[model samples]
Target: MKRRSNLLTIGMLALLVYFLLPLFWLVVASTKSTGDLFSSFGLWFTADFHLFQNIGQVFTYGDGVYGRWLLNTLFYSVVSAGGAAFLCALGGYGFAKFRFRGNSTLFGVVLAAVMVPTTALAIPTYLLFSKIDLVNTPWAIILPSLVSPFGLYLMRIYAQDAIDDSMIEAGRIDGASEMGIFFKIVLRSLAPGIVTVLLFTLVATWNNYFLPLIMLNDPELYPITVGLAAWSSQTAGGGGSTGDLLALVVTGSMLSIVPLIAAFLLLQRYWQSGLSAGGVKG
Candidate 1:
């Protein structure tokens, strides 16, 4: 038993290092000047530290275009994640508690959708949005992100066990309207599930690249993912100024992940509880 435990411990430590090594490298690389990036060892910092300078360049480049991209990301992620979570909670609650025609069939369709990759739907979604003249607009990103089949499925499973039929019945007995019951009672109960879904959608939208690339041609409207990619492409092309842009890209990449890390840290408890509850119920 002790031998087995030691092996497991060693395995877990290796996995941890594997996951964190790149992040460690990113932190180390961000502190180096672009020239030192290639000259110095990747895993360690050099004599000169340029993290602050790189960050300033990231924001000041192209007249603070990176700041615009950062704001766009925040807007898109927050709006889309919040809307998707709410819609998922509503749809999930309906599927879980209400009896309706085609309930099973519709839910099965949603389950099937969960298996379908969002990338596959991107072109079709873009075509549909083009017909509606939403192409190149923020809606092109926000609207599509608001629909999460997986979040709906998660909320359905969570709501099934998170909410009790008797509490809903009691609310209805008191003449609470459907919307009132949802907002006043059901939503409160769905907090953990909602936060879980919110975090999922938030990260997805924040990291989204291809969709925004296809949807928006305007650089000002780009998210951090797309914006950093643009900078990376510039670096790839190789010029006298490539080193500067490369440093900006690395620093920007590090800065972009900060919010996601903060979000996971802040919501870790709720996320864990939601997963635990879902696991138990499943």
Candidate 2:
């Protein structure tokens, strides 16, 4: 038993370091100058402490471009996540509760789409959107963000266990319309599932780099991920005077992840409760 406890402690420590190592490096890098980044050790702080200055430079660079990118990220993540959650709830509830023509086939298609990654569809999506003039627009991101096969699957599973057919029948017997029952009764019970889907969609949309890279050419339209990547690229040889901008890039990257962290913390309880409850029910 003592040996097993030691092994468990070691395992937990290893997992902790594995998760926190990158974040630790990121925090250390954000406070460094470009020269210090190259000369000093990767994990430790250098003699020069430039965190605040680097943060200022990040926002001020390119005439406050990082701020615009941050706002763009906020907008995209919030709208996309909310819309995705709503759609997921509607679809999941329908699939879980209602019997319709081709329902299984349609759900199966969604599951199949889940197997095909979004990255694989990027170029094709870009071409399709380009033809429709949706390229370089927020719609390019927003429209695609609304469709989450995984979110739908999660909600469908949760709705099944969370809401019993007896409950639906009870509502219907009370002369409630299907939509009315959904809004009043179903919404209250599906809270955890909705939060789970919202958090998933929020993170996915927040950190999306590849999709926006192809969809948007305008810097104003670029989300934080794409904007920071563009900055990071400038430090390469022959990439221009961006060698001095490395600190800003690192700091900007750090800043960009703050909202995501806050979001996870805020929604974490709901996420855990919902997932664990769903797991037990399943």
Model 1 bad stretches (over 4 Å): 272-282
In model 2, the Cα lDDT at residue 106 comes to 99
Q: What ranges in model 2 sit over 4 Å off?
A: 238-240, 272-282
Computed on alpha carbons, the lDDT of every model, listed in order, comes to: 0.93, 0.91
Model 1 Cα lDDT, one tens digit per residue, 72-123: 9999999999999999999999999999999999999999999999889989
Least accurate 10 contiguous residues by lDDT in model 1: 273-282
State the lDDT of candidate 2 residue by residue for 1-282, as single tens digits. 999999999999999999999999999999999889999999999889989989988888899999999999999999999999999999999999999999999999999999999999999999999999999999999999999999999999989889978889999999999999999999877988999899999999998999999999999999999998887777765355676788888889888889989988988888678678778867
Model 2 accuracy (lDDT, Cα): 0.91
TM-score, prediction 1: 0.95
lDDT over C-alpha atoms for residue 24 of model 1: 94
**Native-to-model Cα distance after best TM-score fit, residue 31 in candidate 2, in Å:** 1.0
